[model samples]
Target: MKEIFEYRALLIELVKRDIKKKYRRSILGILWSMLNPFFTMLIIAMVFSSFFKFAIKNFPVYLLTGQLIFNFYSEATNTAMGSILENASLIKKVYVPKHIFPIARVLSSGVNFILSLPGLVLVILITKAPVKFPIVFSFVPVLYVLFFCFGVGLLLASITVYFRDMFHLYGVLLTAISYLTPLFYPKEIVPEKYMFLIKLNPMVYFVDLFRDMVYYGKMPTLDEHLNCIFIIIISLFVGVVVFNMNKKKFILHI
Candidate 1:
């Protein structure tokens, strides 16, 4: 705990560096962050809204709510996994917690995620989704999601240090997980036989919780909410075990 506290300033500095460096030269600058997901939502909304012929009421908000949040999770883990490899030069330069690097990645993505919320609000107003009390009051889900991201980020960061192949597998997992998790489509779309499989994935609950709060303006089922919290706790606990075991070796490998 003291080591983590000692590294706090550097963590803030690294997170700032990541945010600035990510948008240093571009003409649009950080606006690209907002635009990238905006465009993705548009493309998806067009395809699904047209094909299903189901009225995707406020399609952008519906899509962006899920896309923006999920993108944070996906981007944070994938980028953070290679933190040690990416900072090989600094690995030996100073004594700091290696876990801080990947965590910094999560922090950077989280800042962007918060900034992007205004666009979601604009879409919500335009789409006429109810501006409910829960949307304003529900910080609980955000807390859970952050825990989930941190836990997953730590695990991925540790793995990528030892197994370079793990980085490539991250892409494949994201592709498959996106479909399996209910983002663009609803749970009802899945066949009854496969419904159990979707339920088993912990990510499904988080996504559903987000949709319920932002899109449907309803709280998730108590069971679903509790299950997600449980998964986050377990994932973080395992991540810490793996990361602590691997930390000493990270310097040597890098």
Candidate 2:
């Protein structure tokens, strides 16, 4: 931890580089962050609305809430998973905490997520969803996701160094998770038997908590809070242990 704090400048530089690199040739630049989510919600909502019936009120806002939280987790972990290999040359040439690469990727993705918040606000305004003090507490859920990403990102980054196939495999996992999470649909429609499946998925808590606050105008329940705390603790513990144990072997594999 102290090492990261000391090298924080390098971390910040990497984050800035990632942000700029992500949109280097793009015409929209950073603005695309906001538009991407908005358009995604619009398209998903339209397509799903046409195909099936949903009683989910303010479907756009509900979808947006779940979409934004999941997108951040997906983007952060997917990018962070390859962080070690991405910085192979630098890691071999200079000494830096190997964990910083993944951390930087997650932080950079987080910047995009933050920039995308205005789109959510815009949707809320358009939908005229009730905005109350609890809505401001939406940040709590996002913060939970950020830490969740940190743990998952670190573990993936370390594992990918040894097993390159994890890169492709993680993509498949992300696809499955996107569906597993109730992004476009409501939990009410999930069959009773499948409720256990939904409960087992960690993203459920984060997405549902955020949705509860942002879309439903209520604070997250006690169970939601406890689930998040447990997830982060277990995630960080496994990630840190795995990363530290295998970090020395990274040079050979990378």
Candidate 3:
């Protein structure tokens, strides 16, 4: 804890730099973070509502819930894919915990997610969707999501340092997992025989929990909550093990 505190400034600095670089030179600047996801959700909602004719009301809100959660995973892993490579010079010049790079990447995404919250509120208010009791209890799942992101970021950051190919592979994996996890559709749409497979992906639970709290206006089952915890624990375990074992090679490799 003392060590983490000592490096807190470095973490903050990296996160700041990420947020700035993310919007640098763009005409909209920081507003892009807010607009990007919102517009993307709009397009998706339109497609599902018009072309596919999914009879869901307030589809934007439903889509936004998934977008918000999936965006965290996407942004964190996407940034993490090249974290060490991008900062090779800095890593070589200074002695800091290599883990900080991935943590900083995840923090930047967290900042964007927080900024998007107002839009979420506006949507809920405009749509007049009933906020659920689970909203009061949603903090628990959010914590699990953060831990899962941290763990995955750590693992990806370490691997990307050595295996440059992982960057490309991860992009494809992210796309595949996005559709596979029911981000655009409900679990009920899937055949009953395959329902069990969908639940195994872990992300499904997070998305379901978010939807339940925000859109469905209900609490998810205890099993759904436990699934997220399991994912967080296992992913963090792998991440810490791989990161500690290989972080020593980061400076040399990068």
Candidate with best lDDT:
2
Residue 170 Cα positional deviation in candidate 3, in Å, after optimal superposition:
0.6
Residues forming the 10-long window of minimal summed lDDT in candidate 3: 49-58
- Give the poorly placed runs of model 3, Cα more than 4 Å off: 51-55
lDDT assessment of candidate 3:
0.81
Model 1 CA deviation exceeding 4 Å by range: 53-56
Q: Mind giving the per-residue lDDT tens digits that candidate 1 earns over 1-254?
A: 68768888999999999989989988998777777787787788878876444745666676777787678788778778888789878878987778888888888988887767766776777767776665763456666777788888888888887889998899999998888877787677789999998978777777777777887778677887888889998989998888889889887777
TM-score, structure 3 vs. true: 0.93
Models 1 onward score TM values of: 0.94, 0.97, 0.93
Give every collision pair in model 1.
none
**Predicted structure with the largest TM-score when compared to the true one:** 2
Q: What is the C-alpha lDDT of each candidate?
A: 0.79, 0.91, 0.81
Clashes in candidate 1: how many? 0
Instruction: Write down the worst ten-residue block by lDDT for model 2.
Output: 49-58
lDDT of 1 at 195: 92
Which scores better on TM-score, 1 or 2?
2
- Predictions: Cα RMSD each: 1.7, 1.1, 1.8
TM-score rank order = 2, 1, 3
